[model samples]
Target: MPGERLTQQERQRIATGLAGGLSYAEIARRLDRPTSTISREIGRNGGPRGYRPQQAHQATVQRARRETPASARAAGAPLGAAGEEIVELAVRTGLPRMTARVHVDLLLSEDGRRTAAELTRRLRVSPASVSVAVNYLVQYGYARRERDPRRRRDVYVVDDDALYHSVMLSTRHTLESARAAMAAAEASGADSPVGRRLAKSGAFLERVSLEMMESADRWRALLA
Candidate 1:
């Protein structure tokens, strides 16, 4: 069922299931499909609130037709091991696979900028899917959105300081958590075993935050 396409009947069933307030997992169980399939189907079309079976079915068909040739071409031009490793690293650093793949694709592109349509054709994904991935990239500071003056389409530009921003965000979160932990430890009395453990954790996180800041400064200096 790896490459299975949902039938119109199945789409109707999914719409009905959503109307009846069934969870995605329950709907998937009824259809003998994976929950991710159900989730993707719903996500691609209007979500649970606005999903329409007929519309969803038609959209799916159109997407399949559009992507068929592109997918075939992509298969012939595989991303080498290095590209795959970049995607894997992004995933390990907390990006979803699709988002990470999109990020890496942008990073590898010659100009580091692409329109949604271009990304859709290159990645063999729907415009909606590319939009979702690009939105994620933009939100996390990995990419920026700009309007093309000559065209109506929006373009996504990869940020050169993407990794630095991501690390800085993480470092700030760690420092905040450490501060909260220290406050909790103090409130619980410093003599208690739980308080001592919390203090240790907070100290470690603080050190990590400091080290991250120092590293970021060094990298920024090199860039300058």
Candidate 2:
């Protein structure tokens, strides 16, 4: 309902339309779909000389399969834990899965640095996706942005100090939030199984966070 699907018949019509010197808008109007939709479909499937209905249909099917629900995909080949986490985080943050994937790739790079345009070119994705990915990384403390005087756009870096700083900040915030949650649970006499589990997690988080802060301080001093 969002966009009229281009079927084999439509593909043939597209070929015929081209021979008749019909514009994309004219073809779209006849096909009852948006001009942009038709443009993208044709552009991706083969564009002008290479367009083939069966090939386009197969490509569409494959793309759909890749994006289908995990359950609907092959059994026992479930998305691994990291993949699942990325999907969940993308959903919660309203970011696309591809953005998370690109950011993660940049973060895991040996140099931990890349310019926005460089990332777009490397990933072969739209500039919008690159922008969203970089923003998400900055938001989560996994990456930091720095502008080069010579460059028009910002460069994202995954420096050790920046990463440590982000982790420490996030860990501290999590500890504080968990403490508050623990207090609320106790005040409500929620010491049942769920409450007890949550309280234990809070204590663990507080202790771990303090240790991490100490480690970060030591590392910073050593760097200095």
Candidate 3:
């Protein structure tokens, strides 16, 4: 559903929806499509003000005809084998694909830092995409942003305690899950067989997470 092409009828409906001042999400809901599909269609097809469904459809046809070479085009410079592997691992750890790539790029940088523009140029993606990815990294405590006085630009720097923060994040989730399980156990009558199993599992997870947090804080203090 996500990757499917928009039908001509859908394009016409999108045009009508846009004319009716409907939001992308609303239009997407009407069409049973992802909001991103609507946004991208409008963005690439002369934007909201100039979007012409027929022209856009024709353009899509032409683009598809020319896509073989475009698909084979290298995504700028390769991130190197190790960097690529790390990016994949980061994605597996729940980071979004673009966010993981940006994080890995920062991690592989000389000083674990890069500006939004630098990221855009290196990643060969739009500035908005870089902004979103870096914002996510900063939000998760994986990185921080600082102003470069001379350049008058913000630079994203991977946190020196990123690993420690990562451990804490993992522990926090485990602890929360344990609490949820315990709550469910209580609701189901803790003396019941299933409730007892839930309680035991919850207790184990809770204890282990607390121990990990304590050890991590001690290690962090030692490193400091």
Candidate 4:
């Protein structure tokens, strides 16, 4: 199992562990979490030179709050208070708290992209969490993984093309599926309101799909 969240006792243990000159792996073994997790938790909040449990916890809360939704971001609330408020809003809005945070963080980024290391530093989260967020955003079409030509690692990027390409592809798939369903319904002679509605929907889907496809192709050609 993943480790339980660090409590005050655990925080004290971490400080003691460090003072005792135990390696991160040793500390993690005692804490029942991955070494990388411990390393990131410490690295983000403060290093061995100056790690304070209360301060680390507060810093994590602040990082979480900074990535909350736009409305919350605009409120200029205190970190701890804002994080709690955002969680309440997340429950009401059906937003997966961490997922929303990741998306909002990406949206707020000036360059629309950040490396995993950069995110780890910013969010005070484990690298695993950062990886999960990046993957979620990429899979949901809200972000894209772009290979850095000069480097081995890929960065998650949000861009107009990411949204446009996702929408266009989805539209094309919907059009094709609609066409197939329409043909089958027509052949079955089940010309009820449902069938008629299906046909009409297919027509609309096809028309919009074609327009989007043509526009996308033109844009691609221009860029090429």
Question: Over all chains combined, what TM-score does candidate 3 have?
Answer: 0.63
lDDT of 4: 0.63
Sort every candidate by lDDT, greatest first. Answer: 3, 1, 2, 4
lDDT of 4 at 19: 47
Q: lDDT scores for all predictions?
A: 0.73, 0.63, 0.74, 0.63
Candidate 2, position 133, lDDT: 71
Write one digit per residue (lDDT tens) for candidate 1, span 1-224: 23346755467667656754569998898777999999999998999999997888778766754665755435423345677688656544445556766787788889899888887887777787777788867865778899998998799988667767766766775676566566667766788886787678678878988998998978775543
- In model 2, where is the ten-residue run with the lowest total lDDT? 71-80
Candidate 4 residue-wise lDDT, 52-108, digit = tens: 867775565556557678874543232245454654463333334455456556656
Q: What's the distance in Å from true for residue 141, model 1?
A: 2.1
Superposed model 4: Cα runs more than 4 Å off:
1-100, 124-129, 147-152, 187-193, 215-224
Rank candidates, TM-score, best first: 3, 1, 2, 4
Reference-based TM-score of each model? 0.60, 0.48, 0.63, 0.44
Q: Per-residue lDDT for 1-224 in model 3, tens only? A: 34446644467667656654568998899777999999999999988889887787767756753663543335624577787688656644445557777888888899888999989888888998888788767755778889999999999998678878867876776676566567667766889886787678679888998999999998896545
In order, how many clashes per candidate?
0, 0, 0, 0
Model 4, position 123, has a per-residue lDDT of: 61
Relative to the true structure, candidate 2 reaches a TM of: 0.48
- Predicted structure 3: clash tally: 0
Worst 10 residues of 1 by lDDT: 71-80
